[model samples]
Target: MSGMDPSAVPGPTVVDRRRLVFGVLPAAALLAAGCGRSNDDRSDGGRSARPPLALVYNGPQGCPACPETVAALLRGAPRPYRVEYVGGETPLTAAALADARLYVQPGGGADLKGTWRHLEGSAGAIRNWVREGGGFLGLCFGAYLAGRNPGFDLLPGDTNGYIDSPGATVTDGRDTVVPVNWQGRPRHMYFQDGPAFFLDPGADATVLATYPNKTAAVVVAPYGKGRVGVSGPHPEADASWYADKDLSNPDGVHFDLAYELIEATAGRR
Candidate 1:
């Protein structure tokens, strides 16, 4: 909140879906039968299968850089990790969520209105899945979706009062760099139109990072047996992103931040 500037950047509007592209295939095929049952039902004693990380990639409503984001996540993860890409006609079913350990919603649409409108069918399934023990990581638009909304409602009361605080896409969509105090260090993160979550009286989330304004840039909480986390900026941005914007990050700090996010939310599984 403090270091963030209200400067206008250039990019697609929150509802703009014209430039959408679907380029990546799922890293692993989703098993239809093992929906929400025991995750370790395939080993010697019918041990549960290793849980894979599920990522939402709705083309039209998804961020253009989502593929790169996923790639970075995969690179940062330990070997033998399994990741899956959902959406783009692939349904996010209850069985799929139950079989997995974590679910990720990348940044895209400005508001949950359009996101929920299209993926409304998976809403209940996701909520139930997380409540049952699945982990969740939401970035940018994904963060807003977790808040008080008709969508997934994974974080219902958490966003009660700050409905309007940077909820929509920044006035300008241009890529820019902003300073964020993550954990404790001042790190640079890619900024677009991202939210600064305002927790309500009964909100259950814990603020992890914030802009200079003290606006929440990252927050995490437990939902039933699972965990839910959200970020208002793109820590997943790679070197190409910085190059494109003429920004410099020789230390690859953003990737470290991204790796930490995965470890914090999905790594446990």
Candidate 2:
């Protein structure tokens, strides 16, 4: 978290609890400890450990749950991951993403234009990166931003087309718990007014999951040599999210799904 500022996103919700839960432990440390962060992992290895997967964290949209997203990825990732936070003065650049294997756009509540502005000229870089076999994961707002916007248009054929963006794809600003049919079972997950993919005819995207309305809740599309996956709900929601929403998952079925999502995005790598 040294190179990133979790508090940069101005809002009442953007809290930095990453340090509290993670402390001096790096991502790999948390993994060795167990599914939950434990003090035992601290003595396992030095902080110089570098995982095979490299991720870029896009933080310009002022995502309050950005840190939580990172925590979930670290806890559930199939392989070791290294994250590079991109935003503020340190704009997301082609050079930065050159060596990264995956890029994650965390959930946030901010104007698309303003959020997209952070990567003004970096869209092509991102597109090219993924097109060359890199991976991209968009969560909630990140999924919405990936649709065709005023910027580079990472995911085209979106129903909104940058006009009334988020257009008929979502229930305008509505945040609530919703049921998602994943694989083949129903899973209750946290849904903020996230984009339900309405791909145009002949769209190359593949539906990974669907909402009750049959609208795409999660999708993976091929862009040249790379692949991009977007999810309309927060599978990585932490305990605080469930507590505030008065929701419970005794079996932790939803939590395990987060790892599945990550594996799907990581693809064969």
Top of the candidates by TM-score? 2
lDDT of 2 by residue, 49-125 (tens): 56645554546554444644554555345565655567644567888777777777766534555556666677888
**Candidate No. with top lDDT:** 2
Q: Cα deviation of 207 in candidate 2 (Å)?
A: 1.0
Clash pairs for candidate 2: 131-225
Q: Judged by lDDT against the true structure, how good is candidate 2?
A: 0.57
Candidate 2: how large is its RMSD? 10.2
User: Residue 71, candidate 2: how far off, in angstroms?
Assistant: 4.5
Candidate 1: stretches off by over 4 Å: 1-51, 62-65, 110-112, 156-173, 249-253, 267-269
Alpha-carbon RMSD of each model: 10.6, 10.2
